[model samples]
Target: MNPTARQYDTVIVGGGPAGLTAALALTRYRHRTLVVESPEPPRNAASRGVHGLIGLEGATPDELRARAWEELGRYGLAERLDGRVEEITPLAEGGFDVATDHEDTIWARDVILATGVTDQYPDGVEGFAACWGRTVIHCPFCVGEENADRSWAWVADDPDHLGMTATAFRAWTGDAIAIAPPWLPGADELRRSLRERGSDLVLGEITRLHHTDGDLRAVELADGTVLERQTLLWPQPQRQVPLVERLAQDHALALNDGYVTVDEGRQTSIPGLYAAGDLTGKPWEQGVVPAVTAGSAAADAIHFATLT
Candidate 1:
């Protein structure tokens, strides 16, 4: 631990929606909090705007973050540091020593792992990367309203997830198609559900995407079949940030699948270590509202724990 390290009641590892919300909650409770964020582009950097947020609908990720910081500025108990957290060392005396890439060390009595996850898209899909967050989306509810009634396709890696998403997507668009990878398990029940919902199921290896200026035109199959589509919902697999992964490995924090497992209070398996947002395992529950709720809940838990 550095002798000159700054100390706070809690240190937030990520500055995304969850981190910012937790910071705000802690500051409101008069608890000293520090938010550490990297200079790299956020996961939602390419997203045009956030949806399902009550009042800030259609606001870009930058705009949302700016507004959060603006609100945080009103509270003097919260501080922001721009740097990537390299490692976290649990102090024997109780607390944590957080090391950053900038060589700054921070000490905190409690830590909130809101580092979130990174979306992993399918490889070798031309134009897919460019259209991500616009024409190529993940959640149907998030982008459903804007792209409603448009030709839509649900490209999924798993058969179960594909069937579920395809069924739900019908609420937004009637012309929903489920494009399954060749390795996806053949489930007769899933196929029946899709057909009942008037959704088409196509099994093929996706070769590439045809698009113009981030707007999707069609999905090209390996067999030279092109399915015209204006919007695509791909619930891409998400991986935890490196910081969270290190903590999971070192501290033996519980995890469900790839996401960090947390109790109802957002408390991780490790004492004094809490987590929120996308890092917590909840694929169907990914959105700004749930992230904010998790952050707020985690902060409340921390506040109560400190009192005890």
Candidate 2:
């Protein structure tokens, strides 16, 4: 069933840290906002603290969201709906009509895309999928502290990405190992860095992952040797949602490899549409800090819209 329009000044897509953060910012600016969030939870590792944000280091992601939600209530301008946004149409009145999976419509003067990205893990890696956000992770800053002093391994499906992952993991663990696939760049440098960092460099094809009840125990190579490790750190390739692709097609929204492009102010290519967080495509995906900053900037830009 489709929902009818409930008037709002801004409609934010996604309910994770990015979307939630943006909702808070919009309310603080006193803009009536509707945040449409799916019931599905993020698969990323649980965050202990939001890094790179001054004065909020070591604060859990949940804690940050809770605090922000409380502040947003003071402004009386935000509402949350537990449903997925199915589509968005630009209205003739210089606003947008956002349609949800439940058929609810939200009419807003502006739209904010806080929809995040998803990582596609390589295929045929047994037990690998189960270890995600647990012993296997993409962001070191998000999961490294918990893995401190544990035997860590960097597994690459392609040799080219080995050096990059290996170099990054060195800062976290001296016991780290780099396992490269065939044809990657800078092998000697990667090996040297591993040695200098007191880590190991294992170059070969990974045969399989040996685990006990989804807890990673070791990585089995083709040679039949098991490398003992408690955690695996690597990046996963991501793809954006089709709704964002349509957003770019209908509007002049700029996209870099399918991610919505935004300026320092977080405004999208289209007027009144803003983007932030993972959808904005920063190099490192700095977690909560990026989401919060982008959201605040988007709200500030929308405030300018009222003045103009």
> Whose lDDT is greatest here?
1
The residue-by-residue lDDT of candidate 1 on 115-233, one tens digit each, is 87898888887788898888888776777787888899888767766776555766777788788876667756667788887776888888788999988889999999999989988
- Candidate 2 per-residue lDDT, tens place, 52-88, comes to 6677676676676667677777787888788878778
Per-residue error for 183 in candidate 2, Å, reads 3.4
Those runs of model 1 whose alpha carbons end farther than 4 Å from true positions after fitting are: 1-3, 157-167, 183-197
TM-score computed on alpha carbons, candidate 1 = 0.93
lDDT at residue 279 of model 1 (Cα atoms): 86
Candidate 2 has what TM-score? 0.84
- After aligning candidate 2 to the native by TM-score, how far in Å is the CA of 152 from where it should be? 1.9
lDDT of each: 0.86, 0.74
